[model samples]
Target: MKILKTIAFVGLFVAGTASFAQNADEIARKVHDLPDGKTSSFTAVITLIDKSGKTRAREIASYAMEEGTTDKSVLVFKTPKDVAGVSYLSFEYPDKADGTAVDSDSWLYLPAMKKVRRVSGSNKDDDFQGTDFTYDDLGKRSLAKDSVKVLGEESVNGVACWILEYMAKDAKAKVSKRVYWIGKDNYVTYKGEFYDRKNNLQKELVCEDISQISGYWTTKKMTMTNVQTKHKTVYEIKDVVYDKDVDPKFFTVSALERELVK
Candidate 1:
């Protein structure tokens, strides 16, 4: 939900680590701690691409901010009349100190139903809207929930990266394990892989067009592809700003109905 985390970009999520003396827990923590600015706003052109390459695009205006240890974000569809006024709001909290996970609260607004549907933690495995991103992918999962291991090094786009394999401690987790290729150069997330409980590769997230904006490293473009379904969603970001003053109303459920962000 904050992903939009990282715009999925806002934090669709980053962190620093030292070369020597790094363990799986420490590395996972650093990766989990990756910097998403205090506040951010941007317009993302989301395109759904099928294996045949036919595409459909939708415009979404997204706003996100960090308040204390909590992160809040809102996304409203702007174009494609049918989906317009379709919005989402969420509150993501930091992990508990005891290493327990704190579930995120998210709600979806539909114009036809004229009611807001609350998205529960159980739906974390569900697709986000119709995109390849699952509800869980957009929120921050606690580090304590996973047993992460460093799978050694590899290169993505020629940049050295740490291959990390994260296996959920819970045997019944919808997603069995995830592999992340995190950049060693700046610790930027270059790519990610998601698998199901059956241990089959499910989806992949690849980030590109990374740049430093307003002194923060940001990923401007990303694609989430479903390996099994062969369907993909591409996010193209524009007008991105960090640490800007965001209206408090945007974070509320009322904003979802009011359509106040535009």
Candidate 2:
């Protein structure tokens, strides 16, 4: 009886320690690690699938500067000749956990239309290019801005992962709730669910085709599906190079005026 009790105590201790591990902050840290501020260039294939299951695909070349508060970024359409010179500029910031910064300003410049639009709290949920993903979904958020809570562990695609959830404090922010699955060993997010103001499952984003670049776990493919509309967008990354020299001007408003073909 004494030996059995001792074994039971040992089991409980192991279980307790495991339960205490894997919290929200850890998961947030992994997400923050996704992009190092270092520069890089890549080609992406953006596919749009409508509720009718019609798919439209476009190839785009993009350059990004992640170093500062500017979050200078630009995307230029490469294929589908009609979109040539269709470019955009934007500065993104990491949001605080409580989402209190709903008023934080982000800018966008469109060259084909020659318009620079600003995003505000009220219209943050507006779609980008009539796609399923909203502005806030593409917006940046610093891990320091939000508090993370680990919702425990589960297996995703046979990989053990930590489930984490986050909320923004600024009651008015677009996505009120988000859940993430962080791989146990790789620390890459494999799946996530975003909930809307009504706490309904608004969208689901899945990360796939993960490969290591510069010793970093990265996903070369991602898909965002809108549950409300049954529409989906697929993003495929190519020629991805990390910490390489990128032309600073590639991220400017001029990027919108030029046909950036590689």
Candidate 3:
């Protein structure tokens, strides 16, 4: 009878774990599917600080729109004469029909080259325009790309959050694992940590200045720090608008080239 009882307890524990994992996945989907508007635009100031405390800043205008199961965005550099007219475009897709992970596509247009070059998958881990953020960081990652688990609860910036852990499904992924602290009230991510293939902490990101804009919760300021190098980048959004009319062609590679000539 004791052996049978032990076996029953083991079964109960396994069932409970499976239920918890399902709940975690549901929460992750909610976080991923948070509604922004159909279209949005904003200007941001990106400041980079190096380990030696040296700093550089740039201004950029960003536009994004939702198209079916995909989200697209374009970035145009506005200031700093030398870098002006440069643009970056990205398209992020939802999970494949078979529920497999797929990386987003990104391209860069340089006025000097006058050509739009595709950003390859191998370069997704590289920094974006000298900023601490990687190309992957700029795009929305599908939940299908990772296996998620709830890591309990925590408080971030005085806001209650549900801590979640994620492990990449691909062995070649830039980040092996990630942890996110998502706000319980707004479902916004408050903080995140990234680990490299070697299982060492690579970067940390913190989101602040949360506000409701056009009925959607947004993070007005974000900072990402490369823990190993002690370099950081801070981005502040301004002049944000949602559901604004945007030219359909603006998201194309041809538009990226045309905008530089303007």
Candidate 4:
């Protein structure tokens, strides 16, 4: 009788652990869907401050949309006098996801050049437009495209975190692997580590200033660092309001040209 009772207790413990893992996986899956597939618009003010203390600032009004499995995005800059007419469209597919981005294809629209140029495939390691996030860093993955394994739990900045290991199931992925630190209560990602083809640590991302936007938890600022060159980029969103109706035309090429700052 003692042996039977002990076996039953162990079986129940195993079942409970499995259930906890499943719940954590489901919560992690929802983190990427905050944007959904809806067309949206926002005004962003970018401020670039170099290590030398030189500063450049621009206010941009733009629209974006993500569709289906393709995940196409367009950013039209309507801001500072110089970069006003600049625009770009990025079409991303989950080339790889092991808790980090390995590679992606991006096309930039050059108004003066009047042509679109394709960027790199494994360019996630590269600085984005001389800023912080690489092209691959902007790419997002749905849970269906990858597998998530619970890597136990940890504490980050006094917050409990569930470490999740995400791996691209696609055999042709450019990235070797990725790991994410997901907040236990809110399900927001606080940090991520990316690995290169040889599985070397290539990049790190830290997200801070989480706020409630449109009744959802959102990060107001994020910093991405490239370990290879010791370069860093910081992105901050201010004066943010959500659920505003965005005109479809705002996302088009015509809008990119006409919305130049005075």
Q: Pick the candidate with the highest lDDT.
A: 3
Per-structure clash totals for the candidates: 18, 14, 0, 3
Clash pairs for candidate 4: 98-166, 98-178, 132-233
- Candidate 4 — worst ten consecutive residues by lDDT sum? 253-262
| Order of the predicted models by lDDT, top scorer first | 3, 1, 2, 4
Candidate models: Cα lDDT each: 0.85, 0.71, 0.89, 0.65
lDDT of 4 by residue, 1-262 (tens): 9999999999998998798779666866666655532554556666665655576766655455554555555665565666656666565555345555434356666566666566765444465566656565655654555677777789888889988877766656656577989887777888988776677787788888986777757677787676766666667766555555555554444444554322
For all predictions, the C-alpha RMSD in Å is 10.7, 4.8, 2.3, 5.4
Put down candidate 1 lDDT per residue, 1-262, tens digits, no spaces. 6534454342221222333225667767777787879999999999999999999999999999998888999888898998988998989988777868888889999987788889987787888878888877776777767888777789998889988888988888888899999887677789999999999999999999998999878889999999999999998899999998999889988887766767
**TM-score quality measure for candidate 3:** 0.91
Could you tell which candidate, 3 or 4, scores higher by TM-score?
Answer: 3
For all predicted structures, in order, the TM-scores are 0.88, 0.79, 0.91, 0.71
RMSD of 4: 5.4
- Write down the lDDT that model 2 would get: 0.71
Per-residue lDDT tens digits of candidate 3, residues 67-118? 8877999999988888889999999988888988777888899988888899
- Pick by TM-score: which candidate is best? 3
Per-residue error for 254 in candidate 4, Å, reads 5.2
Which portions of model 4 show Cα errors greater than 4 Å?
1-24, 35-40, 45-59, 65-73, 78-84, 90-107, 117-127, 170-174, 253-262
- Greater lDDT among 1 and 4 belongs to 1
Better of 3 and 4 by lDDT: 3
Residue-level lDDT for 161 in candidate 4: 93
